[model samples]
Target: MLINCVAYQEGKKLADIPIEDISEYLSHPKCFVWVALRDASPEELATMKEEFGLHELAVEDALRGKQRPKIEEYGDSLFAVIQTVEPHGDELTVGEVAVFVGANYVLSVRRDAQQGLVGVRARAEREPHLLSIGSAFVLYALMDAIVDRYFPIVDALEAELEIIEEKMFASGAGAQRDNIERLYELKRKGLVLRHAVMPLLDAMGRLYGGRVPVLVENCQEYFRDVHDHLARILGRLDSVRDTIGTAIQVNLSMVAIDDSEVNKRLAAYAAIFAVFTAFAGVWGMNFEYMPELKWHYGYHMAICSMVIVCGYMYYKFRKSGWL
Candidate 1:
């Protein structure tokens, strides 16, 4: 769907023009048209291709959707695919925005993305001086907006990890299974973020310094700021992933410790019962010639001996912290 098609000249909004008039605006030396679309139809893409003289391969990638986040150059124009990530319950919803930027036009096609770049256009209009730099400025604005959204997600992930860690430690050997499951889920979310940020981090590096793209040459500083933001996010994401791994291991260790304590308790009980069983078995043999069987206090002596021996063994077990 076509969200908006507007033309601009000399850092100011001229008017909201129809798509057909885009070519007319392109003819002017200092004018450019900005277009936004959401889940555009194939027909709309073909029309855009003809109107803007977009490269066929770029159009195909946009039409196909799900292109890896990247930036490709087609002559003086640039095609960039940026992934849009949003937190959805416990999962991250991944989306894509394909941007076609030329010297005089910028066309953004958003696919499977809930949020739109409408605010970007508003902010650009509010700052005419930066918008005056032409399509490159718009590209940077769109990318910056997308990259800025990543901060909140990273913050949320950090908060979640802290919560899980606190609960796991506080409960100490309790609910270990649940803690491990939550940690793994948190790790999955981090992976989603990694998938979104890493590729773009690499892609953004090319826009600044040492033979940059012609369209973004004048606006390298803005793009560099964006690159820095991506780097920060990537760093935080790596930290979260590493902490999650550690948390998972700790939870498993707690489980193992709990199991070991249970086994020790069981072994201690078995040893105490074994002493009584041994005494009872020897007495139950009932040898007719056994002298103790004829003694009047023989039963009392056997009972007292068993009690004394069992008590000593129990004391030892308790002292060793095994019972």
Candidate 2:
């Protein structure tokens, strides 16, 4: 669905134009048309292509969605794919935004992403000085908006790792188990956010230096700012991944330690039982040569001996911290 189609000239809004009137504004010097679409259909993309002279491959990629985060240059226009990250419950939901930017027009198509660029448009219009740079500034604005959204997710993942670390030391078996699962889940989300941000680092470099796109030549600093944000996000993602890996290993070690403690207790109990069994097995044997059985106090003496020996063993086990 088309969200908004507005035209701008001299860094100010002209009017909200219909889709059919996009070409007329495109022809005007110092004017650009901005169109926003949500889950755009192929027919809509085709019409956009016709209006903005968008590359066929770019339109195809936009219509299909699910493209890896990237920026590609086709002739005089640029196509960029950005992944949108949003928190859904305890999980992260990923979406895509495909932008087609030219000297005279900008088209943004969003898919599976709940958040839109309405704020970006408003901010751009409010800052006419930057918006006056033309379509490239719009591209930078959209990229900057998407990149900014990633900071909260990175912080959330970091917070989750800290929680899991605390649980690793303080929680019981069941809670620790849940923490391990939670850690893995957060790691997965971090990776998803990483994939979304990592590719843009290199792709965006082309916009700032060395044969830079004409529309972005004067806005190198803006593009560079976006790159720095992405780099920071990628760095934090790496840290989160390493921390999660360490947390998982620590959790496994805790499980092993618990198992070892259980084994020691079981072994201690078995040792105590073995002492009594040994005494009974010896006394249970029926033979003519059994001299202790001939005495009346022999039965009482044997019972006392068994009890004393077992008690001694129990005391030793307890003192050693095994029971």
Candidate 3:
């Protein structure tokens, strides 16, 4: 669906034009059109293609909506895909935004993403000087908006990792299992966020460095600033992944140590029971050859002896920290 189709001239709002009128405004040298769409259909994209002269391959990719984050140039226009990451419930939801930028127009198609570019539009309008730079500045505004959204998510993941780390050494069968599961979940979310940022970083580099696009050449510093933000986000993402890996390992180690301790206690108890069973087995032999059978106190004396032996063994085990 077409969300908005507005034209701008010299960084000022010219008029809200219909999709069919886009070409008329494009005829003006100083004017540029910005079109926003949400889950656009084939017919809508076809219309856009006719109006803006968008590349067919770029339109197809945009229509598909799951393209990896990237940027490509076809003749004078640039096609860029950016992944959108949003926290939904306890997990992250991944979406895509494909932008087609040319000298006179910018077409943004968003899929599976709830966040919109209304704020970006407002921001660009407020800075007419920057907006006067045309579609390139608008592209930067959109990229900056998407990259800024990532910070809160990164912070959330880091905070979750910290909580999981604290629970790493916690003692409980259920708690240990929960900690491991949480760590894995955190790692998964980190990868989702990382996937969104990494590709965009590479794409942004193209805007600022060698043979930059004509529309973006003058805005190298702005794109560079965005590249720096993505770099920081990527760095933090790496740290989160590493910390998650370490947490998983440490949790497994604690579980192993706990199991080993449990086994030692079981062994100590088994040894104590063996001492009593040895005497009992000897007495249970059905034979007149059993000498203790003749004495009335034999049963009592045997029981006392078994108790004393088991008690001594229990004390030794306790002292050794195995019971």
Estimate every model's Cα lDDT from 0 to 1.
0.92, 0.90, 0.92
- Deviating ranges (above 4 Å) for candidate 3: 286-290
Residues 1-323 of candidate 2: C-alpha lDDT, one tens digit per residue: 99999999989999999998988898999999999999998899989988888888889899888899999989888999999999998778999999999998999999999987899999999999888889999999999999999999898889878877877876466676887889888888988898898888879889887888776798899999999999888988998898889899888888777778889999999998898899889999977889998988998999899889989989999999998
Ordered list by TM-score, greatest first:
2, 3, 1
Q: What is the lDDT of candidate 1?
A: 0.92
Tell me the tens digit of each residue's lDDT in model 1 across 3-113: 999999989999999988889989998999999999999999999999899999999999999888999999999999999999877689999999999999999999999
Worst 10 residues of 3 by lDDT: 165-174
- Worst 10-residue lDDT window for candidate 2 reads 167-176
lDDT of 3 by residue, 1-323 (tens): 99999999999999899987898999998999999999999999999999988999999999988888998999999999988899999989999889999999999999999988899999999999989999999988998899999999999999988878777778876788899998888888898998889888988878997888787888999989999999999999999998888888888888888899999999999999999999999999958977899888999999999999999999999999998
For model 1, give the 10-residue run with minimal summed lDDT: 166-175
What is the TM-score of candidate 3? 0.97
Stretches of candidate 1 exceeding 4 Å from the true structure: 170-174
Global CA lDDT computed for model 2: 0.90
> Would you estimate the TM-scores of all the predictions?
0.96, 0.97, 0.97
